[model samples]
Target: MTADLQLWPIGNCQVSALLNAAGSIVWSCVPRVDGDPAFCALLDTAEDGNPPRGIWSAELVDQVEVRSRYLRNTPVLSTVLTDARGGSVEMLSFCPRFERSGRMYRPVAYGRIIRPLAGSPRLRMRLAPTKNWGDPDVARTNGTNHARYLCDAHTLRLSTDAPVGHILEERAFRVERAHHFFLGPDEPFVGNIGREVSRMCDLTIDYWRYWVRSLATPFEWQDAVIRAAITLKLCQHEETGAIVAALTTSIPEAPHSERNWDYRYCWIRDAYYTVQALNRLGALDVLEKYLSYLRNIVDEMQEGAIQPLFAVSGESELPEAEAEKLPGYRGMGPVRIGNAAALQTQHDVYGQIILPTIQSFCDQRLFRMSERADFERLESVGELAWKMHDQPDAGLWEFRTRSAVHTYSAVMSWAACDRLAKAAAMVGLADRAKFWSDRAEKVRETIEAEAWHAESGRFGASFGRDDVDASLLQLVDMRFLSPDDPRFIATFEAIEERLRRGEHMLRYDSEDDFGLPETAFNICTFWLIEALFLVGRKEEARTLFEQMLARRTESGLLSEDMDFETGELWGNFPQTYSLVGIINCAGLLSVPWSQMR
Candidate 1:
C-alpha cells in the first residue's frame, strides 16, 4: 500500500480533509453542528459508505514534494508543493475574520493558489464540492475567474482574485508565472488581488502573535506552552466563546470499529480546565465571552436538565446520524455525528461549570454586571447540585455501558456548591449564599463518609465500583483535600502504582467501559503534576513535568491519549482540554500560589 497522508478538515462550517496531491475527505452536516456527517469517508472504507464525492479526488501526476505549516500563530494554513518540472505552487486556507450577530450561521472556506517566483507551475488540480455528504447533483455556475457550486442550503463559490486561465468542464488547471488563484463563496474578483492576499496573510499572522503574547507565565517550556495555548484557542468558537473538544469528528477509537464519535461540541468538564488556562494566561476576553455563552444556554438546556455537551450555537437537539458515502480514515467504520452522551446525566457538569467561572472571576477580577447575572445562574446550578447530590449518573467518562455514582463527579459537585457559596457571598446574595454554604458542607461531609475507601486509602472511581480513577487527582487541584493529607498522598501513590503508564497517567482501570485500547490520559497526567506540587513533591513534580513536556509532538501539540505500550499519540489531535491541562500544570509547578495574583 502507498504511504497515504489524510488531512481531514472539520470545523464549525466545514468537514473535510485534504490528502497530499488530490485525494481528500470531506464531511458536513446540514443546518447545525450536531447533525450527522454528510461526508464521512474518514470513518468507513466501503465504496458505498462514502459520501459527497469529488470533494476529494485523486489524479495521476508526476512526482511532487509538499511542505505545510500554519502562518505563525494564526489559523491560516499554508501548503507549498513542487513538481518534477521545477514549478512550485502555494496553497493557503483560512476563514474570513469578522464579528457576527443574529441567529444564522455563515461559514465560508477561503483557499488561494499562487505560482512560484521563478515560473508558473504546470499543475493539474481537481475541484469536487459534495452536497449532503457526497449526495450528487451539485449545481455549478461559471464565472470570469472562478466557479460556484451550490447544493441544498450550502453554497461553495470558487473565484480567483487574480487573472488566470480557466479550463471549464475539467477541474484541472494550469497557471502562468506570478499569477494567483483565489476561491471561496461570495469573493469578489474585480478588486486588487495581489494587495488583498498580502493584507490577509499579514493580518492573520498579527492576530495570532498578539493573542499569544498575552501569556504571563515564563515557564521553562515556554515554546511548548505557547503553542499548546494557540491550539486551544483555535478550538474556541470565537463567535460564542464555546470551546470544542476537538476539531474533527468520527475518527474511530479503533480501526473499523463502531466506536467513532462526534467531538465538535463544547464539553462542560473540558471547558472548566480550558477557561482556567485562558484565565491564567490573562486571556479573559475570550474566557468571559465563553462564560456569557454558557450563561445564555444554561436555561435553554431542557432534556437532561443540563447536558454534558452542546452545539457551538447552544442547540440542545443533537441527533446522531451516519454518512455512508465517505470511506473512514485508515478504514475506521461508521463515521458518526451528534454525540449521544449529551443526554446522559453527568452530575459533575454543574460543579465543572461553576467552579471554573468563579475561579475566572476571582483571578481576572472580571466581575461585571453581566458576570453577576452569571453568578445568579450559578445559584440555580447550585440548586441542581444539591438535588442530584445523592443520585447516580454516567460519571465523567460518559461510559456507554452503565451509570454509576462517580466519586469525582460528586467531588466536583461539592466544589460547585462551595464556589457558588463563595460567589454568592461576594456578590451580596447573602440569603442564597447561606443556603449554598450549608448544602456545600453537607455534601462535603457526605463525600468523605461514602466516597472514600479505608482499606484502599484512595477515592474510588465511583461509590459502587472500588476502582480508582485518574479524575481523583482533581482532589488536589480543586483543593478538596489538603495537599499534605496522608490520604491524598496515599491516593497519589496508589494511582502511580496502578494507573501510571511510564510517566503519564490513565483515566481508570476499567478496559471494557471506554471501548478503546487502554491508554494514558494526557489531561490526567497533567493533573497529577499539580497533585505532586500541592503535596510538597516539588522536585518530583518538576521532574515529572519535564518528562510530560517530552511527550508533546515535535510541533508542540498534545493529543487526547497516548498509547501506554508504544508511547504514540492516539485519539484526537490538538485536544484543547489536554493543552489547558499542560498550561495549568506548568503554572502551578513554576509559580507559587501567593505570587499568582
Candidate 2:
C-alpha cells in the first residue's frame, strides 16, 4: 500500500510543494511545476533494507501525534508535532511569494521556521532533495552559515540561522529559540535571516488573506469554495499565465492499475473549466492572465490547429516517456514524465479554447477588450470545429487504442459556432452572425440525428457506439440542450442508471486501453452533480455534492480519481478539474446575496 499522505500544499505561483500529514515535505517540482521533482517521496513507499529517499522531514524525537492545518484563509501551513513526553515543535512552512517592489517575487525556494513550543523537543532535519527523478545524491559544500548543494545542473543553497553542521549532519538537537531555514537558488541572503523570513511570512499571510477577501462565495460552503479557488489559482504558471493539470505525476488512478500518468502540463479542456468556474466568483485575474497564454498558443498553432494539452511554456512537442525513478507511488512502477496525449487531436479543444475568449469580448472588466481582429483570429478555430464536428478523432477521453466521432466533441464544436453567432451579433456583424448561426444549427441537427440512440431513448458515447458516458451530462451544462429538454432528461437518466456507481460516476463502463476502470474519475461525478442541479434536482445535487466534498483530503483538496467503494483519492493532486466542481456547485446551490439580505 502507498503511504497514506494527506498532503498540504504551499506555493507562490512560480513554484509549489506538498507536505504530508506528518510534516514530510514531498512532491515539489523545482523551477516550475513541470520541472523535475526536487522532493518526490510522496510517490515512494519505504521498503525493508532501503529507506525512502528524496524527502525533507523534521521529526521531533518520540513523536506520538501530529496536527497540521492551513492558517485561516492562507496556503501557509502551520504544523505541530508533539512527543509522548509532552515536548512539541511548531513548524511554519511556505514558499515566499508575494508582491515585492511592485513585482511578483516567487522564487524556486521554500521557507521554514521551527520553534520550541512546549518542553525541549529534540529535532532532526533531513533535507535530501533529488534531481533527474531517480538520482538523489548531491555533493554538499558547506560555509559558515549556509550549505551550497551542487548537483547536476542546478545549485541549491540552504541558509539557516541555526548551526549549519547540525542540519547537514541530520543529527538530533534541542530547539532553543525560533530557527529559520531558507532553501532556494544559490545566492547570498541579505540582512538578518530571521528578520527577512519573518517579514516574508507576514507579507505572504497578508497576501493570501487579502486575496481571499476578493472572492464572492456562497455563505454555507464559503470556506470550502475558497480553498478550492486558492489551489486552482496556485496551479497557474504565473510567468506565462499557463495553468497546469495538477502538481504531481505517476499517482495511479487505481492500485497497480498501470494507469499512472503525469499531470503537470496544461490542458485546454481542464484550464477552460478552471477559469470559467473562477469567473463565476468574479475572479477575473485568472481569466485575464490565461487569455494571454491562449493568445500565444493560438498565434503559434499551425493553420489554427490545436492540441489537447501543452507544456506551461507553450512547448508543443511532449514525447511521453517513463521515468526510471525511485519506485512509483507505492512502488507502482512505470513512472511517466511527458504526456503523449499532447499529440492527439481532441476536437473539443476548439470550444475549450473559444469558451474563455468569449468573455474577453463581452466582459468590460477586462483591460484588453476583444476587437474585430481578435474575433477573426477566433474564427479560424471555429472553422476547424465546423469542419471536423462530424469527422472522427480521439474524443475528449483521449482514448489511445481507437478513435470515433464523440458526441461530446460535436456538441462542443456546436457550442463554438453557437457562441460565435452571439458574439458576432454583440459586435454588430449581422451578416457574420447569421453565417455562424446557420453552421451551429447544422451541427446541432447532425448531433440530434446521428448521436441519439432512439431504442435506448438517450444519446450514446459516439455516433455508432451504443455506450453511455457521463460526459453527456455536459450537454445541458454546456447549453447544447436546455435543462428541461426531454432529450437531456432522458440522457441524464440513462447516465445515472449506467455510469453512476453509488455516489461516484464512471467516465464510461466500456473497456479501452486499460481494462474496465477500477476507480471513478472525480470530474465525471462533478459533472453529474452539475447536471442534477440544472435538472431541478436541487436536493439530490446538494447531497451528492456534500458527499463528494467529504471525500476531499484533510486539507480540503481533491485528486483526479476517487474510489467510491474504498474512498481512496488517486491520480494527480489538487486537481484543477475537481476544484472547478467545488466552485461551480457552491455557486449554483448557495443562496444569493440578494436573498440573504
1-597: candidate 1 lDDT, tens digit per residue = 112222423232232222332323343443333333333333444455533354433222353766656566555556666667766666665544432365322244444435553344655554555566645567877767777767565666666544323334444455464444444455455577666655655555565677677667555567767767766765677667778887667665443445567788889888777877877788776677788777877767554368888888887777877767655556564656678898889999888778766755555457544457667766777778878876898888888778878888888888888888888777778887888888889998888878788777777767845688788877877878887888788888888788877777888776656454466778888887888788788898889888777766544566677666666666655577778877887777675556547
All candidates: CA RMSD (Å):
4.4, 1.4
TM-score against native, each model: 0.86, 0.98
Candidate 1 global lDDT? 0.65
Worst 10 residues of 2 by lDDT: 1-10
lDDT of each structure? 0.65, 0.88
Whole-model alpha-carbon lDDT for candidate 2 = 0.88
Candidate 2 segments exceeding 4 Å error? 1-3, 594-597
Best by TM-score: 2
Residue-level error in angstroms, candidate 1, position 412 = 1.2
